[model samples]
Target: MRIVEAIGIGVLILLAALALLFLRRMVITRRGGTIELGVRLSTMVPGRGWSAGLARFAGDDLRWYRIFSFWPGPRRVLSRRGLAVDRRRAPDAAERLVLPPDWVIVRCVTRRSPVEIAMAERALTGFLSWVEAAPPGESTPDTRPYRYRAG
Candidate 1:
């Protein structure tokens, strides 16, 4: 009877902790000026495919947070200056499971390291605009003129 009561108390404590974590995530996501969009992230490593998550545009950088993580911080940050879009494509069969439906993947090189991001077509347009819109008096790393390409 004593042991059963202790076990029940422990379970309740764990449940309370999980509820607090969920509320914390909700508050941070809602108050951090976050953009709620599905994003798939991939590194340059061979055979390591994409992982989907939520991307938040914070200042001049984009922060990506894992979908299943309980933490309230981003796992990756891509700066505007170092980001360069290399190509765009539709996700393969395996990638479809991770990414949102009809979303396009944009392959990019940032600080000479390759990264892939997936987002909706409309969001991609906004992302391109954000990247291209450098502050006045500052030149973009890619000094060449900007041209939109239809994929």
Candidate 2:
């Protein structure tokens, strides 16, 4: 009887935690158009440093939040002024198994720092649009257009 009661309590706690995480995700996504993607936070190791995240385009800044986090703030914020697209590529065979079929990997260059963002094709389109958009008097990252290749 004691063992059964303990198991029941543990299951209830787990469910509550899951519900909280779901609520947090809903709140985060409700604020704006959030694009789901995988962000490489660092160059730790192969298939190790990548984390699933949600990115929101807020004017000149892109705010990224971890998908499965309890925090209410963005984990990273990238400014469009310093961001530039380096290249784009389709995920390899092993990565295809883990990520979505339509997802593409984009390498972004920002003040000598390189970051990789993996997102769906449509999301990539929206991201590129935002990166290219600017105010009437403000210029984009560069004058030359970026030719992206999916290799």
Which tens-of-lDDT digit does each residue in 1-151 have in candidate 1?
Answer: 9999999999999998889777756765785645545543434544245665667777778988776677777888888777777778877776776666868877767776777777887788788877787677565647312433446
Question: TM-score per candidate, in order?
Answer: 0.73, 0.85
Model 1 superposed RMSD (Cα): 3.4
- Angstrom error of the Cα, residue 146, model 2: value is 4.5
Clashes of 1: 0
Evaluate model 1: give its lDDT: 0.70
lDDT of each: 0.70, 0.81
lDDT of 2 at 105: 90
Q: What is the C-alpha RMSD of each candidate to the true structure, in Å?
A: 3.4, 2.4
Residue-level lDDT of model 2, residues 9-93, one tens digit each, is 9999999989988998888789777899788886765654678988887888899989888888999888877777778987776
Clashes of each: 0, 0
User: Which residue pairs of candidate 2 clash?
Assistant: none
